[model samples]
Target: MTRAAVALIYRRTDNSGTQLLFIQRARREGDPWSGDMAFPGGRMQPEDASPRATAERETLEETGLDLGRHGRFRARLSDLITRHHSRWRPMVVTPYLYEWKGPKAVTLNHEVEHLVWVPLDFLAAEENQGRRPWRTPLGTLNMPCCRYQDYCIWGLSYSMVQELLAQGLP
Candidate 1:
């Protein structure tokens, strides 16, 4: 089994106190989640000591923002779900939440085409409501959706967002 990690990076904006960083995946041929909005992260490398290290490393690799330069770790969730990517087998995805206090300039890699800073208010609004089809070992399932910008941040990302929101925004 493989393991992965993702950082749900966020900061406070002048207009809105809290804003999330979402990436628009670069359109790649044969990529499963191409062009979808997602958090900054990837599969864990051999050099990674732990899942947290993998999260921090992948965040910097994908977004060019170091998590250590930001505030201390707010929360860490483990063994959320394994959203199988066709190229890769089922991966244990660990989600990390970090509070950032600085400029939001993202240096995207080839895997990312564009980025969006979505406000929490907008995400909690009714406009972002929808439904998503999910496939699991049990069977096919349709879950509620949370749309952000041009993409619907459903699936595991949506579950992580809900967890963060339930814990109260930082």
Candidate 2:
């Protein structure tokens, strides 16, 4: 099985609320997750010492956010498995949570088309949670997700949020 890692970066607001950072992947042909909302991450490279290291490196490479310089490791959410399908292979993904203490401005690389800081409160609200039908390589299916503005957080990203919420906010 393949393994990957992602950084779930968040920050505390002046009003005591928290916001989590997400990236909109740039569209590309043959990319299964193209144009989808996701965290800063990618498949583990040989140089990575651990999953945490992969998350840190990917965050910096994709967003120009130096987690090592401004992030505090908070928790490791549950590892999630991607569904096996004809167009995609199953993989395991480890998620590392980080509290960001740096500037709000981010320098995105080519992999990321846009970024959004979504409030924790907004995600936890029941009204904002629902299942949306998505057409995949298999067929159209109703998938659980959280909608924020024009982006929809689903699949592994959504599972990570659920795990984080279940573990209680830090």
Candidate 3:
């Protein structure tokens, strides 16, 4: 019934090249994506003007990093296909891509148990490639995944990363 937005903040280092930010969710029971690796974001609020604002707000709330203070806000990517949760109705997720030029330590909130900076080149590596079986209301489906460090970034997050890398990377 409603839509959400997510921010995919990435950094380009002179030596290491591009790196994407991934946050490890806290081990909370009854959460669909519990203890999984994900980007910084959540559902849009009524006060937010647009999905972009929702993304910025959620990123700040989850990661404690201010895009306005650290990096320049870049272009917003096209909206991904709408995903529906069992409890909630169908919702569209619009993902935004922001590039941080300078380097700074990341501070994650309690909602995030750990944080990782994954190299872009390793996204499709052997160790990162995996599969996840999901039984949604639509039906049973097998989803491809990329696990980096200790977090398994699969499903919509993985799909978003794949699309962003394909369309936004230079």
Candidate 4:
């Protein structure tokens, strides 16, 4: 089965609050998740020793944030499997949580359009939880999502976020 990994990079704010980083993938032809908001990650490569390695490597390549050198490993959320009707074949997604201790500078690569640091409280608040329409091969359906500013976090990424929230912050 296909597998992938994502890094849920977070940091503590000045007021002792937490913020999670999210990235908007660059729009590109033939890309299923183009322009979608998601955590920094990608499909696992053969050279990756573990899912954690895939997450760290992808995060660094997409956002230029060296999680391997500057991040502290935290909780590991439950694996999420893509639905059959997803753009691609069903795949196992491993979400790795990390507390970023790196610099403020972020140099995004072509894979990423832009990145945002969303407050954990904002994500946890019930008021921010809502649904958004998603177009699937079957039909357009309203999917549970989190509305953050102009971005809507949904699908597998949303599932991972819910899993993280269910387990509470580390």
Candidate 5:
């Protein structure tokens, strides 16, 4: 089965410049991306009218922020397809960009393990660039990663950040 998923790439601006919200997924045994840092989102549900709605809905459910009420929908960003094919189900994800003025507080739901506000400038720093070890059935290999303090942002989360940067937002 092919699934459609959506994510919200939320940015906040103030006197301190801009920062993005990233969440660490809670550890779950069967989840492929468990404990990974990612934008708040998930598979599309029946009630979601479109991919945007899916993003908005998931954002609310995961972060307790009603994007419809709190965020200014900017523009739709890039859509990413699953690079590694799965024998079971595959997914395509569309990300929506939303900007919030001033500062915002996040109240994470159970689906999230932790939340980190990633400073835009930190991402551009050369020191933040590193590699993370990814273990597969074959062996462990180092994958490109961005580190902030103790949190390591890599894989799809890193790719999404690249897309957002490519749009000339920061």
Candidate 6:
């Protein structure tokens, strides 16, 4: 069966421009997606009332940011699914989006190794587009990606950003 997940998209405005929060997962031998840059989210729990609730809960668990208290949440963006080599059995994953209110620095849990607040304008730039050969245990091939300094946003994470772009930028 396909598993369900949700992510909280936190964005904020500054004199420079709007930025989005991204978390880098800590590398663990057992994690299929270890060390990947991703949004704050995870699989839905039985206790979660809805996809949005799952997103809110995971955001708090991963970043110590409570969307209900310190932030405003909008159920914007559409769901995205990807088949991944997860620890779980054969599955497709659904990711729902909840955008947080403002630019708040994050306090990450052990599950995260780093945090990146990517500028929206950087994502919209054509110069940032490129392809690179990425090797995973599964194999290697050139793939579409966006580079920002030491980070490369690709795979399903790239898909989500594409959706965000398609929705039109401010």
- lDDT of each model, Cα atoms only? 0.80, 0.90, 0.80, 0.89, 0.77, 0.73
TM-score of every prediction relative to native: 0.87, 0.93, 0.86, 0.93, 0.86, 0.84
Summed over model 1, clashes come to: 0
RMSD of 3: 2.3
Q: Tell me the tens digit of each residue's lDDT in model 4 across 1-170.
A: 88889999899999999999999999999777789899998788999999889999999999999998999999789888873335567888899999999899988999999999989889889999998887877999999999899999988888888878888875
Q: Each model's number of backbone clashes?
A: 0, 0, 0, 0, 0, 0
The residue pairs that clash in candidate 6, if any, are none
TM-score quality measure for candidate 6: 0.84
| C-alpha root-mean-square deviation, candidate 6 | 2.6
- Predicted candidate 1 versus true structure: per-residue lDDT over 1-170, tens digit per residue: 78898888888777657888888789999877888788888888999998889988888888788897864578896567575677456678999888886556768788888878788877778877788887768998888888765677876777888878877855
Give the per-residue lDDT digits (tens) of candidate 5, residues 1-170. Answer: 34455554556455666788888999888777888888888778778898888888888889877778878888777777773333545567787778754236777888999988888888867888899999888999999889987788998778878777767774
What digit string (tens of lDDT, one per residue) describes model 2 on residues 1-170?
77889999999999999999999999988877788899999888889999899999999999999999999999888888874333377888899999999987789999999999999988889999989788866999999999999999998899889888878865
Worst 10 residues of 3 by lDDT: 80-89
Which candidate has the highest lDDT of all? 2
Clashing pairs in 3: none
| Stronger candidate by TM-score (3 vs 4) | 4
Ranking by lDDT: 2, 4, 1, 3, 5, 6
Judged by TM-score, which candidate is best? Answer: 4
Q: Which of 1 and 5 is ahead in lDDT?
A: 1
Instruction: Give one digit per residue, the lDDT tens place, for model 3 in 1-170.
Output: 67898888889877967888888888887887788888888888899998988988888888877876775777777777665544556788888888876547666778899878889888846777888787777998988888665567887789888887777462
lDDT of 3: 0.80
Please state the error at residue 117 of candidate 4 in Å: 0.4
State how far residue 43 of model 5 sits from its true place (Å): 0.3
